[model samples]
Target: MTVRYAANKDVQIAYEVLGDPATGVPLLLIMGLDYQMVWWPDEFCEQLVAAGFAVVRFDNRDTGLSTHFAKGDSYTGNDMVDDALAVLDAVGWSDANVFGGSLGAAIGQALALLHPERVRSLVSVMGTPVTAGTLRTLRYVRFGTVAKLARLPKAATREQEIDNLVTVYRTVASPGYPFPEDWARHVATLSHDRHPRDPGTTVRQNAASRRFTVPALSTLTRPTVVIAGADDPLVRPVAGRDTARQIPGATFVSYPGMGHNLPEELWPDIIERTRAVAR
Candidate 1:
């Protein structure tokens, strides 16, 4: 799929679509930190389409083909929300069922809190709640994994970038499931060739996310599904369970041997639960 641009004030958000909106449920797939829309695997998206969804995947600002920002550039979390709304607007979807992964799931939580009407349903995968305080949020993360990530050697070329990405993903990959090195390489290559990622994007996104003032998750009225990986070394499974507990009647499901990565074997389970909530 080719990319399309949505104007959010001055920033141009990049997005792509699969399946027709008229024929299926409107679903926006938001990726996580430092990742682009291409990270949403093609086969995974085709499966979503086959499962009766109009899938729209997008690159957040300062990532992918979206408008870049300079170091020290400051933006409110509302800007991030507007960027998402812009993509939905450009796609002609007034509201959508959102499936967000990791940081993207946090963004979806923020969306649900800030503009509840705009979110039909939410599926949060391997993520913490935006409503959690800084200290609380920190408690859910494993700094050992973070420290290892921080220690990765910097990439100076295209090949180096792809290799680094593969390494990073492998670090958090499912221990019980076979790692899809080939698919990871293909995604890494596309991310590298599609548009070289700006080194500062992660910092900028983290800053913007921190600026968001989220209310209690208990306030959310929409149906939600929280999928946690029991083997996740980053955000602990308890976080998703806690998030589910906060929402009125949110469903919480976890898989053993599933780490931070989403193995293809679990797609059927994830999609079916998400479909139930969206319906």
Candidate 2:
């Protein structure tokens, strides 16, 4: 079921619940910036469901059907983390396992750090550690393109938008990795159709992350698993290795040939691992 709820920041978060609501342990699945819940892929969610997890997926503020804060409003990535927690509260779930990828993983780290009691376990996929050096190169590469895309006027044509997004996919997406172009185009269209892209917020969020380090990595007490793509160029394996080292009891899993994209092929194993962590 799709739902909307007001957050403390006054943003209306958009979310969808998957699996049998009454079955199994609840798991909150958060996607990256500007990503919708569907990005999690049906098979992945279903695999988790089959593994006895009720999954909740959502679009963050300024993305998908959620409330888009107007340009020029100063906010922090920390606020985005709070937004995740708010979504959990609004959904009426007191505690749940957390799974996130890329930017979503960073937010999940923030949530687990800030609200330890609310997260039972954490699965961070292709995510970076909270250090300036860890992400400096990535921010440099991604910031300019995202800033340009976000500045696009609301009147931009769908074809033009898709073209711009295709370029973005080429850059940010794992090189040599096969992208579901049609699926990505559809997602881009839906994002623009739902809300105007805000250049300022995207820029702000990127900058804010530099100052934000997850100090809780050292103190994270929950069962944790860090998944890194062997060929991921952006968030290199070094980052994931460092993150795992910092978490006292966390385990690290690096795939042999996987790229940053979470292909449907990996869902079964990922779901199995996630279920094991929950157990």
Candidate 3:
């Protein structure tokens, strides 16, 4: 994978492209929370590529190799939305199909709402709509609890960091799907050794999400799909359903016994749904 940087004002966003850019439909994948673009899974990207899409996955600002903010620096959710647009511009695509998970989904919603001309289609996976009412519902209660509990203590060593991530995944993983503890630990170790954890950046990103509020999604006109895990402890199915309901003609799909994490088994279904919506 050739990692490239896209300039969004002073901040530089890091991204990688999969598949033949010239031969397939352009699809942008937006990752959630403070998770790096690597969390999107190379296998998943390959499957999407095989399904005929030029997949572009990026690290949002304050995460991965992207521009990291100082402790007190502040940026709103709109900035993140604009950063997504900058990635598209850097990649020479005027518009592309967008698929986002969790916070990435929120960013996609804002992008489709504010810059409708730039989104050909959208797929929001495991995300809640950006509204006060939705945020206050029971759907978010479990997620909020898990999120709070997932907060890790300062790790003085790489091993501790990996352990923390493993614990978090184990805590939030779907009860039915086997939790890949060994693989999760390996990835966590690699990520921690590579970039280390930046709690400050995560706080800033969370602030942005908390402050953002989209009053109504009725104005969004692009073709949209919301994919949810039926057993998702974080960002429950209702959140996905509500997001789909708010947008005109948006479709919602649910996977049985799935959680916030996207398992490899669901890649085919996700790719098919994306193709169907984009069509």
Give the worst 10-residue stretch by lDDT in candidate 3.
132-141
Where in model 1 is the C-alpha error above 4 Å? Answer: none
After TM-score superposition, what is the CA distance of residue 23 in candidate 3 from its true location, in Å? Answer: 2.0
Q: Which candidate tops TM-score?
A: 1
lDDT of 1 by residue, 1-279 (tens): 778999999999999999998778999998888889998988999999999999999998888899889977978666887888899899998899999899888888888888888899999999987778678888999899999988989898889988988988998888879999999999989888978867688788877766778788999888999989999988899999999999999999999999997899999988888889999
Query: What lDDT is obtained when candidate 2 is compared to the true structure?
Result: 0.73
Top candidate when judged by lDDT against the true structure: 1
Error of 3 at 152 (Å): 4.3
Q: State the C-alpha lDDT per candidate.
A: 0.88, 0.73, 0.84
In candidate 1, which residue pairs clash? Answer: none
Q: Residues 61-130, candidate 3, lDDT per residue (tens digit)?
A: 9988899989899998889998999999999998999999888999998888888889999999988886
How well does each candidate superpose onto the true structure, as a TM-score? Answer: 0.97, 0.85, 0.93
Ranking by lDDT: 1, 3, 2
Which segments of candidate 3 are over 4 A away from where they belong?
133-139, 147-153, 213-215
Over 4 Å off in model 2, which ranges?
Answer: 131-156, 174-177, 211-214
lDDT of 2 by residue, 1-279 (tens): 556564756677888787765666989997865556666776678778878888888887767677766656556667778888887887778888999887787887777887899999999887876543434436423345446655654546767765665555544565545667887777666655666455565665666555554555787788999998776645567767877898888999987656667765666788888988888
